[model samples]
Target chain A: MRAFLSSMVTPRALALSALALSFFFMMTLGGPFYYLAAFVITSVFSLLDMVGGQDNSDNDGKPWYYANIQAYQIPFAMLWFGLIYAWYLGTGMSDLFGVGGFLKTHTGFDMFAIRARTTAPELITGGYCLATIWAGFGTTIGHELTHRTWSKVAIITGRWMLALTSDASFSIEHVYGHHLTLGTPADPATARRGESVYHFIPRSTFGQIISAWHIETGRLARKGQSIWSLHNRMFTGWAMTLAYAGVFYMAAGWKGVIIFFAISWFGKCYLEAINYIEHYGIVRVAGTQVEPRHSWNCNQRVSSWLLFNLPRHSHHHAMGDKPYWELNCYPDAPMMPHGYLTMIYIALIPPLFRKIMHPRVLDWDRRYAVPAEYPLIVEANRRSNTADFINNVAPAE
Target chain B: MFSKIFGSATKPATVTILPADISFIVEPKKTVLLSALDQNIKYPHYCRVGSCGTCKSKLISGQVRELTDKSYTLSNEDIQAGYILACQSVPKTDLVLEVPKLRVE
Candidate 1:
């Protein structure tokens, strides 16, 4: 049974598995309670990440790359990803023919029914459910697809997924900006050694936005086009985001529009939080090459599987064009103690996150970093009070 | 690190690659994929540990030292076809090879 299940757990399926959650959230619409249920299930997912590190089938299965498995899945997943936006069109409109009626038969969503006139708290909670599902799952799938060098269709679909998050310029900043500058002082995306998740959010998010704008403008100017022209990729992304919002407005009315905005804002924040943990405290010198040492990796079984091996991030940076299934676990890369879901939770609590991550970052410096980088790493760690925290946690003679 | 511990200390070998039609010298005991990349020639590779098969190539001539056990990566049929992972095959002597055409984004 496990083997059969494992066989079905291909990367493409894993990528949009959370699309099912939004479906559920749609069904549960019209009530604060159902929305609460959607949000609470996220905690269950986090718990699974904590306990589910064992993979019985990894030892026995055919190598995941056999017979061009990923080739079929990527297209399938991208299509479904588009369908998700369509699904939102239905749920967002909330009152489509037989839609609310169909969902109402199974769920208690009343005032906040996908189409019902809802209260503020219900709107907030329901939006939160949608936000968590799309941000966590949709953004993940989009990220995986966007990294591909092939398949323009797949790449555009992935960018649209980020458009759903109201942060479509992610493709611009991430591909051109983050890949080039990750772990360096010049990088807006890489969190500094002492930076907390809360602080990192606005800095990375807005800074990347500014950086992406500049990048797109530079490209347009190089091609002799005005920055305000449609030739600017950043403008295209933002325009798509607005169009997506217009569809959401049509789906559920003004309430639908507001809820979509709420979802987008929350989802954008969640995506940034993820970025915060991906390369926290790792430093690189300006204009130097990016080695596998820059990004932190997690090979936790369940999270990596569900997230399509995203935890094996070192190889992703090393070869950004490498497909998700092709990503390898670099033994020499820095590792995160917990999977992404767990670290995400811990990151919210600054002291706790530091206590757990700072020492590990230090270990990365000592073990993996070149000696010339030692002073910078040490100074950064000291500023974060990592040494004092270590002394308190475990003092030595 | 793998080069320091397991790489040969012998003289480097000159390698010619097909498709790209580029020739580069591989440092003693270093893999052909790394050598091509070191010379600023875009070479197709990922997971340089002989895993992903992205660097699979046909070893047309000469000899190379296989750095990884490819029992899992390369099938018997593949081996018979002269297919070797460029990332794992370090040149033992001057060699000619063909790399699969790959588009790097």
Candidate 2:
């Protein structure tokens, strides 16, 4: 009994169970209409995860992934409660004042039934706000966790939350593909120099998904594993999503599923937009090994708070396994000019960004240049005589 | 070796201002911006990573070498027009750069 209780209470299982209960309770309370909406939202994310969650195994062990899971647990739990409370407040407020009466006096809308039937206005709006925050935190954590050694519980919990945000596939592409070939032309996530966020997102989203399919297919072929194999993360994610949609269809029907998809897609897009901003214009030099300088860093306080310190990006790239809470600001890491949100707003204006960024870039360039007295020639000459002694094989080898 | 690493062996270069008739001594290995900052000269900068083009300026004359990290932020056109990142550009020879005073907003 104790062992069973402990298993049920593990962070991964707890979160998964909470999300499931929330989905069912909300649907039952709001009727089939709301349930369909939730289903659609989750199913879409499930599909994305199916495509995105491919081979991301690394021999480096699972400490980092586990750490990320632990780091995100508290914040996500808080966000979940915050959403629930916010919904309760919004509905109570609307009903207390009689939404129809309030609207009739304020906006002059004649649809009495619409206002009267505002079952949970606060719940709808507040739920969305909280959901957005959850999506951000959960998706990042889920992405890391899914890459760990197989834990049936972890996979289900992580992938389910990821799908609800319509970003399930990020787990696969980011860990498996992007990290493996980061800063290279082959990696879709690495932004080219002078590329804007607006242009990078659509291309990366589609490109990464297609690449994920090829990666998984190749992996299965090599290992003699069938596409239908239960061990496949991609297959499992898709199957769960399809199963979810079927559940939605059975419980609340198509309408609930559609609504769920719309909201989840919106959340997913928001997350992707952030990904675009996080590493915009940051590229690793082709044929060179990955280095910290290859990724952009932001240390702004508010953006860091909002995204659980995700803006301290260069370090994350250098050590993807570091838990979000423990991620540090490295002085040598290139710094973003502003907070992530402010930068996102600025990214919309290419010319303004270019004008503002040009000098800073030039300044950084000039700062890192080698001194004239210590030119490459001088260093080469100094090393020439020492080279033979160091190698110990004479010049023949 | 210690003196060389600390940049104490070399005599600092002087930048002579034409109209003001004032001059400042610039330390070796310090970018013009850093030197100016040391002398309490505030300059504009944002996203110091080179992605946000905030700190661009035209070089009037003289040679400047860019730090390796800042190279990605500059374009060929910028190099041709004598534009360099003040934050990145260390004076190779004495430099006469036409830089806009940092805005006081």
Candidate 3:
């Protein structure tokens, strides 16, 4: 019983289980207000960062659960997707048993539907709630699945989730481009000093797609296959998105289409905002090596629990295939002031972001960066207009 | 010491790595990972100093000499499980290897 219970309650499993709660929240509260509620939940987690652990390490032994966890989650993620799809389309059993209906039955009053708010406003939030599901857990699930090299199903399903976000080529660029060139000028995914979410999003979105295109083209080219071959992953990804969009059009007309893009737009921004903060201002030589210091890490327990220790990012970079439950908190890696959720909220205000993170970046340089790499670090700061802040305040660089 | 472990004097050896299903002959005395990088074949690695264990691979069918000590770097079970650190080992004979598909750059 103990082993059985332990297997079911692993941190990785618990983090994924949090996805169902988001759906429940949506079902309980219809319209744009649910987003407000979700945002507050995130804010509360953000404020609790003070007590979060910084040096937690994974336990040495793998639970019997590790083998079957992915197999278990795939169906769960799919069903979660199905429920959100039903709610958004206002179709099938969801037409009566959906968010509005659920509220009416549960509380004996449906404030949203009883008050009879206009479709335009409800639809606006309806789209947002749907997208929130995608970014919050859908993308997280996709990220986990895409890491499996042996399982084509996991890869395809992961890409399928990303395509719903209109980012089908994430695995291609993520594996070949971002990983190969992280913390360097060559990796467009690495947010430079002074690069805000607004600025980073467009550049990363376009650059990643372009990088995936070139990377895929070259890969196929090496095999003597044409760029236009059915093997082109970039084309296949975009085709998947188009097909998904077509399904939305047929189901709910222009309103559904609008909702799809809106949800995708917001989801992509959420995804990129997390990216913007993850590697902000860190630089490494293009082809040299990667260490724990290249990535910024946080260990706020709530964020770790919710995101399955994604905040323990230094370990992720160093041991790429290590499961989330197995990731360690490296003492030497750069630390974030708050959990990922709160830090993302902080990133919206560029000045505060610089105030907090710039000093940390410079400190990482002093401790980990070699003397030969100093020039590169200095140049990166100068190019980003952060040198003055770094030089003036850092301990006698 | 590194050059001697990965220099021009020794006989070149073939390394066959999978998931990619590609094989290539590596420079004499060079770490199998260095040769992979030179060929732009993607292989996992972190902290080239034989820590992090990111480059750990299973030696499917070959002999390798560890340039760095594996006593502390790899667990005894891993060594018994046929795992070799690609970044710290040179093939003594033609080799076959397997790795988990994971993140990279």
Candidate 4:
């Protein structure tokens, strides 16, 4: 029974199952209490699995590289689950139990006063509903197929999931642009030194998308194909996003459209936060043009398992085609102190993040400094220091 | 009679001199660093292709044959200072090398 359950509960499969179960329980239980409990339970377990490292041997041939890639949804899903739980417990229960009677008779607070002061229930519901769709459907499946290891089946499934959140373009840009140019300045996803998460997120997200389109169009042109043609992934992704808006309009009117866009923007932001944490302050050697030292590795046991060993980043860069399951923990790779989710929260506070990460970054810089490899940058810094020294000198004879 | 004949005929082969403090039991054809790693001593290495100089180590006292990948990551000054890539060097004789201690998370 344990083995059977384990086989069935792959990271992607588990997320999808939990989403379905939560949705069904929400409708069937007909009360906010049961719905909140179920969502909370599912979310907690998902969080655990993400943090608790997985045995790579269990993955077999399934490609671990994509594992961490898709695991972004775990935290996103958890955050959404928490919101839904709060709303269901707070508002939905009140509505179901007769808001006026429950408040006045049970607690003696004026129900009318509370209702007038708070935001409308519909907005909260709509926002959470969209969050659920983006986290479970878009991030989970989109992330998996973006790897595209097994077959076209995997890729197609992943893209459709991303389409739900109107971020299908990520599938193309991530594989073509980010993966190829990772750790280099050419890759917009590669954050520079001294850039904060606030600065990096928008730049990386928009830049990567535009870069992906250019890359794909350039490739197609080389092959005598046109960008106007339907064969392009970028066009397909956009069409799917538009279709999502149309679906939203038909399903829930103008509010649904507003809710959908809001959810997508939030989801994209969440994804960028993960990216910011993953490669923070790490850059490839300028002259050697190597990718290994370019990205920082985070192997905190919980984050590694949750992110599909993504925190084992240096290994991934060293062997891009190597499946995630086979990704080894190289002793030499620079490491992050915390997992992606924890780091994301830390990144919001610039001073706190700098305090924690600056020491580690400086240590890595000094320990791994190769004077020959980056002579120009080092020399320039040295010359500037010398100039400072001369200016500070008290009229040296 | 047999013991006397065999013993007098051959002087015992002399053992090669090795560094007193920094002793490395290197594989005959492999570099000192590679030998250390194969023997379960974790050595720092990035871009094993020698593009990154993360694995640079000093040759304290020994001879080594360099592979083609060595020249680029190492500067002319590094060669004078006895720096070599453990991945690229083949130990020609017994050697003592300074391995940098790096913290790997």
Highest-DockQ candidate: 3
Worst 10 residues of 2 chain B by lDDT: B45-54
Residues A178-270 of candidate 4 have per-residue lDDT tens digits of 665565567788765566789888898889788877766755654456778887878888787676656555544566566667766776776
DockQ for candidate 1, C-alpha atoms: 0.04
Clashing pairs in 3: A179-B104, A179-B105, A180-B105, B6-B29
**What are the per-residue Cα lDDT tens digits for candidate 2 across A1-397?**
6654554464434544565466444432332345353453435333433343221122213244444455456345533433333223332233322433554579774323332354555336534644554466566556545543123455556676676565565666775567656755688876544566667777787878777766656556544567778756666666655654454344335653554555566566666666766654443433343446655676654455445567767667665544565567765766667666565546668667656554443333344222431232233223334332223221121
Count of clashing residue pairs in every prediction: 8, 44, 4, 5
Candidate 3 chain B: 10-residue stretch with minimal lDDT = B67-76
Greater-lDDT candidate between 3 and 4: 3
Residue A96 miss distance in model 2 (angstroms):
24
- Give residue A25's lDDT in candidate 4 (0 to 100): 45
lDDT of each: 0.68, 0.52, 0.69, 0.56
lDDT per residue, candidate 1, A1-397, as tens digits? Answer: 7765776576535544564555544434435454555655467667877897743232224355541354334434433333333334454344543544554567643422333344556655655666766677677777876654234665677787788788878877786678877777668999887788888999999999998887767556544578777777787888877776676666656765666677788889988888999998887765455677889988777677667677788778876755666677776678888888888889999989988887887677667777666555655555665453333321111
The stretch of ten residues in a row with the least summed lDDT in candidate 3 chain A is A90-99
- The alpha-carbon root-mean-square deviation between model 4 and the true structure, to one decimal in Å, is 16.7
Candidate 4: give the clashing pairs: A50-A306, A64-A324, A64-A325, A65-A324, A68-A307
Docking class of 1: incorrect
Please list all clashing residue pairs in model 1, or write none if there are none: A30-A112, A30-A113, A92-A251, A92-A252, A93-A251, A93-A252, A94-A114, A94-A115
How far in Å is the alpha carbon of A56 misplaced in model 2? 31
Off by over 4 Å in 4: A1-137, A286-292, A369-397, B1-105
- Identify the superior model by TM-score, candidate 2 or candidate 4: 4
